[model samples]
Target chain A: MDIKAYIILSLALFTIGIVGVLVRRNAIIIFMCVELMLNAVNLLLVAFSKMHAMSGVAKASPYFASDAQVFVFFIMVVAAAEVSVGLAIIVMMYRNVHTVDVNFLNRLKN
Target chain B: MNLTTLVFILLSVMAIGSAIMMISSKSPVHSVLWLIVVFFAISGHYILLNAQFLAIVNIIVYAGAIMVLFLFVVMLMNLNAETEPVKNYRLQLVGVITGGALLLVLVSAVMKIDVEQLVEMKVGDQGLIKVLGMNLFKNYVLPFEISSVLFLSAMIGAVVIGKKDETANQ
Candidate 1:
């Protein structure tokens, strides 16, 4: 399979995720969108890693190898952690405001 | 098309469709369900890439655990279809345009890359769990330990944030 197709699909998913995060009023959905974006990037990163591994010359290059996948593993851990904290904050916001709309979260505004 | 290509096409379609549904559905529960489908499709993609370990972890973490938490939160909130706010057409238009612009940029960037050069690199068989474990325990140990700390912080934050305010009653 051509790598371009995979890249395109990842880009599309990332774009959709960006739109969802920007337009959605619900905090939970926005958080999901953020996850979607992260997943899309993860897909692209893994694809690049595979592409590099398949092409033998990348072995000499310090940046290319299964190490990229290791980076991706860390990214997954970080993303999971982020979602946990983010959802907790969202829950706190809901407790005080009874709503999760981003536009209405203007308490800091003087 | 070969089996790999065929599987890739199918999984691509499934992933994209479910992701679209995840964003478009009015019901949050329905969206979470669609997200589960997306997660499964992504796991299939990982399998296609020969990352068997990643595929299993993907299903276990995202599909099995995280999604269950999502569903539980959705149910606990009692968020019904009626409670969802409707998106205004103007905001939707802006979102579409912004998203479209980002997509265009990414597509163009990808198109300009040289795939043949990338395909010239030799793939090693050292991508399996054995090699990965060796690398993680040897070279990447610091990052690995740091990630556990990060997870600890996140857990503490979740507990503090989710805790009910006892003083409010007084």
Candidate 2:
């Protein structure tokens, strides 16, 4: 597949994620949008890795392509950890505030 | 178009459309479902790109564990379409415009790249588990081990934060 096509697709996904984060009032939804953006970047990284391995320089290094995949694996690990903590925070917020709205989190403003 | 390109287009459409639905859906449960669709599409892309290990991991981790966690939290809070908080339409419009502008700039920049490389698709062995496992256990072992510590900290932090305060009720 053309690398440009992959880039464009990833860009579209990332843009949707950004819009979701900006537009949604729900904190959980916003967090999910962050996950969307992370996945988009992960897709791009994988695409770039394949592209690099297809080129001439990768001949010297056997591990060049696998590096990106390994990085994506670690990213998933971190994302899992992040989601656990973030959802716990959100759950606590909902428990205290009784709503998932991000606007309600403005108590510090006062 | 060939089969690879066709599959690529299909997965891209599925991903983008599901992502749009995920954000636009009124119900949090529905949004989580749509996000699962997005994750599936992304995993399909991974498989097409011959990153088999990442593809499976994406499905198991994102679609299985993380999304289930999201659904559990959403359901536990009793969040639904009727209870969704309303934001200003003007703010939403502005956000859409801003995101669109960013997308435009990025797409334009990406188009300017002169290299027209083809991604190595189903033919590559670099995405195989054996290759990635060796690489992970070799030079990347330190980061991998440190991530375990991070997970430990995160688990403890979540437990600490979610615990009920005994004194506060008194």
Q: Enumerate the candidates' DockQ scores in order.
A: 0.54, 0.89
Cα deviation of B66 in candidate 1 (Å)?
Answer: 1.5
The TM-scores, chain A only, for the candidates as listed are 0.89, 0.95
lDDT of 1 by residue, A50-86 (tens): 8777766547644346676787788889978887888
List candidate 2 segments past 4 Å from native: none
TM-score to native of every candidate shown: 0.92, 0.98
What digit string (tens of lDDT, one per residue) describes model 2 on residues A1-110?
A: 78999899999999999999999999999999999999999999999999988885757666777888888999899999999999999999988989999999898998
Task: Judge candidate 2 at residue B58 and give its lDDT.
Answer: 95
- Write the residue-wise lDDT of candidate 1 on B1-170 in tens digits: 67677888899999999998998899999989999999899888887777666677778988888778878777877776899876798988899898889888879988998865332112344446766677778789999998999999999989988899899899
Residue B164 lDDT (model 2): 94
Q: Candidate 2, which CAPRI tier? A: high
